[model samples]
Target chain A: MLPEPAVAAGKATRGWIDPRVRLAAALVYSGATAVWQKPESIAAALGFALGLAVFFRLAPGPVLRRLFAVNGLLALLWLILPFSLPGETLLQLGPLAASREGLLLALRITLKSNALLLALLALVAPLPFPSAGHALHRLGVPGKFVQLLLLTWRYLALLEQEFGRLRRAAALRGFRPRTDLHTYRTFAWLLGMLLVRAVDRAERVRRAMLCRGFQGVFFSLQEFRLNGRSLGFAAAVAAAVAACAVLEFGG
Target chain B: MHISEGVLSGPVLLAGAALAAAGTGVGLKKLAPDQIARTAMLAGAFFVASLVHVPLGPTSVHLLLNGLVGLLLGWPAFPAILVGLILQAVFFQFGGLTALGVNTLIMALPAVIGYGLFSRFLKGPRAGALAAAFGCGFLAVLLGGVVAGLALTFSGEHFLNVALALILAHLPVMILEGGMTALCVGFLRRVQPGLLPGRPSVEVR
Candidate 1:
């Protein structure tokens, strides 16, 4: 799975951030953002993002490039929003009038999007999937929900792998569906087959869960210890948030 | 698609969270301990199901399978849906942490209602299954779009325009998802009727 590769990269590059620490950081970050206003809060977020980038050992060039590629179209949407939204025009471009208020609003949204994207990259991209799941579970996410998270994490790669195999098999068989009709028919058959297999697999998984005395909640053998360092980490996050709040209020 | 952070305000997100918690509490009270294992399995199934994304327009929309969950779990659909969305948000980052409750309620509430309505009204097992599945699927997507629109509106984005846009976008998706769910439920009913949710007395009968 790509998760394995990502995890390996994270371990080799960035030190393993205990799920607990990450969870604490995320909570603090969210709370701080919620409490504080814009500009100063935005600066705090950027500072956090920078810190996260360093701790996670992320290559900014690569991650930022990837982020831009995925979200580039969204930027275009902002470009149109200014012109399309009614109000006072600040700038005139040929036939279009860009409203000052609308442009500012679009800019605000764009910043929000970028911040969110950066936060996600800093958080999940570096954290191991299992660790992230465990962290969420520890944070009082319901067992059933955690299990779903675990299964999705476990199966997404497998599903992609399976799809790849099926695609290869089709290629080998020289099965080419030309028109939309033929394509839909092939897709339907594929869908039917996938369902059959999924059902069969689910039965086995259910049986396995039963055998393990799965008491609705999945039990993790690894327990998170809230040591001095963790507390220190939490304090640091809190301090940073406090400083951000002060700056926001002071400003 | 997943709504990002800060898109919805703190109040709206908190409200969704509170509602979701209430739903889960009710669901838990109704469910027996023996049902826990089944719920866990279904949660896993729901997670896996979404990964099988069928193409819709430019972006591919995955099956929510909320309808199937309702048909199988009935009132307990709340907890199952909650678990499913929690996993989706954490593992896949499909939605934001704050928005998890909103997403779950939007997707799961319909399934719970569908189960209540269809299970009582429908005659045969196959008919019940089809009705539940189709209804849930159709409504779940519609609700998802609606909720997204609502969130956008709350954020000071366009209300009617956004709502209309979402509804129009999801129209074709609803038909496709509804049809697939109906067929799946029909097949499941024929092959494994026991999988369908039923009271112990019904099994005895």
Candidate 2:
């Protein structure tokens, strides 16, 4: 089964906001935050993202785990950028100098990355995957693309299960993956078999849908209404995002 | 490789988005209504296939399989990979909203290039077929690394070293994927010849 997002189990701000609004807000916020060069503005964006997380009542554990994973890549940047970027040397280590500009760049990246991630988690994570697809469709994304998105989302768990079964079958046959030609060959064949089965299954699925009168269109039962509360939420988010832009570009 | 959010500059991000959008548009245009389900299912399979981790010395690395995907699906690989990246972002938070276009282009463009470079050899003799498969796999990853490196370097001149490091880091995975893709193609050729690109479709009941 696909894991749920790390939203706390209760009424949260996301429940009151429309998914389209939330998605747009997240996109705007992240896009604006991505270009901000000042550390002060980026840090303020982070603070606003944190406030959104709290308002959304996101569970801290899973959110922090995702943040940690993101930072692992940043940590690599921290190691290389400080030494490679040419600027005023803050520290010298055996002929290698850590430049102040590089350090500041790394700091800005870390802040900006965390801020964008937190906003995405707070705004977009609350909606179900299919709901998000439908929201995209309503937001003027191509219908066929949205259909593909929804269908892929529906079958991800099934395909993962199928792969799990294949792995178990291989294991039962005393197959152990190692750093060797035989192991690689075995894995390649396993994946090959999986692809073969997937092709067959896709044929069967297409036929089944055709038998059921499946056209190119997908009909969803979920309807998004723009109520007063959702509008208010949108207004609040727009205001916050506007404030961020001002802070980023002003003065 | 998924480049996390907030790493790329504005122009780089915009250019990536524009290119990805064009690719996806052409891909969607080529896809008929009746083919949507088949494309979606194959995409799901690829998504699952990507999660498989193979041991390398003491650690493991997941498969990219973009070469194989492109070979199988042709131009549809663009939309397929775009959806896959979207699902990854929504489910695992591997990439974020803004970087989606850049990430899609990084993985899918290489897929399309692999198809262009290697699809003809699938019908050739056994040795040539396998060699082409390996080339597809190796070149796809190599080009992906190069594109990613370019994206980073274009973001800032200071990122040149980091970009080079990123390309260097993909070398081992490139070798592994090359071998695996060759064997996978061999297996498909022997078991289900119709599955490979440019082959006559065989009806399987």
Candidate 3:
């Protein structure tokens, strides 16, 4: 696996807050309260979001960039929700009826989603993927699946490079995507070629693997150590989760 | 787009996790010892596929290539997808650990099915690649939306509306994915023709 910020941390310590851990924590936190009918749930969600924002150190930039990129378009639903959803109208502007309840609901959903995103990105951004996979495997994810992940993680980098080369080669050949129908056909043909190449590469890779040892299973070199920091991270997360649960229960 | 944990009910996520485990078992059972290296490499490819996001409309979606994986690897996709999704969540925060099962089923099943069905539709390696690549990507997203809709419905949220909105949003995404798949397949054919599943190749001189 390519050396990444997350991988470096994972190699240093086995029990690190990989992106998956953060994402899972965020998802569970949000999913639990997604369906709550009470306004208290929304308040709790807002609090959780605020807590995550603080703890995760989610800066305004990357968070906004990702949100703008992923959910910016979906935000259009805000307009639709207010007018179409059934509830008391907050405002009457010409033909549009803005429902107070629908607007509140939309606001809650947006806040919840954004919070989840912030928490996940903050938590997962530091760890490498393979280390995270190993963590999951240790947590009882099947070995076979873990193997697949390790392999995918390794091969994807090479393949992506191959893809970059192909794209460059095509561009040099004057293969523009939008010039005409023929260009489109050429583009199609390029994709067909990429698939065939990926498979061929797979065969060579298999052969290379056999020449090395002929045995199945790839081993990761990094060793995991559960030290004070890991326990601390885990404990902190548990406390946060418990706090949320308590808030939910109390409210 | 991947969902996080706590986004759904505990029972639902657990159920999905169980199903994912079963699916992983089946994938493992199907894989031969010799195929492990190839399987791993393909899984890596699948994992990286998502990192390259192609812009479509206001939102951007990356390639899944599960169909291509399924077409090339067959039942091995189960384990492969499991790996890819795990990595995505870990490396990219695309999904969550609890949401892994739902994410896997959402993307991988369609890959397995599309590769199975479309492999027969095309005549040659290029066609097979096109069919598998496009079908896998487009169908995977559609399946994902369906799953998302179902999850929302199960939660007593608005299923149909969400489904419609998601499915509609994904139409252009499908086209973009299809185009990329075709290109990837085409290049593969020129450089390494033997890689495509079920294709007999003349030895490259």
**Tens digit per residue, CA lDDT, model 1, B1-205:** 4455545666767777788788887887676655554565555555555665566545566666666677667877887777666555443444645567777777767677767766553325545546766776677677667776776677565444755676787787777667666666555554454565554223322
DockQ values of all predictions: 0.24, 0.75, 0.36
Let me know the DockQ for model 2. Answer: 0.75
lDDT of 2 at B56: 89
CA lDDT, every model vs. true structure: 0.62, 0.85, 0.62
As for candidate 1, its clashing pairs are A145-B83
Predicted complex 1: DockQ? 0.24
Candidate 3, B104-128: lDDT as tens digits: 7777677677667765533364565
Best by TM-score: 2
Question: In terms of lDDT, which candidate is stronger, 1 or 2?
Answer: 2
Q: For candidate 3, what is the DockQ?
A: 0.36
CAPRI class assigned to model 2: medium
Residue ranges of candidate 2 with Cα displaced over 4 Å: A6-13, B200-205
Q: Higher-TM-score candidate among 1 and 2?
A: 2
| Per-model TM-score on C-alpha atoms | 0.80, 0.95, 0.75
Question: Candidates sorted by TM-score, descending order?
Answer: 2, 1, 3
Q: List, residue by residue over B79-146, the lDDT tens digit for candidate 2.
A: 99999998888778878888888988998999999999999888678888899999989988899998
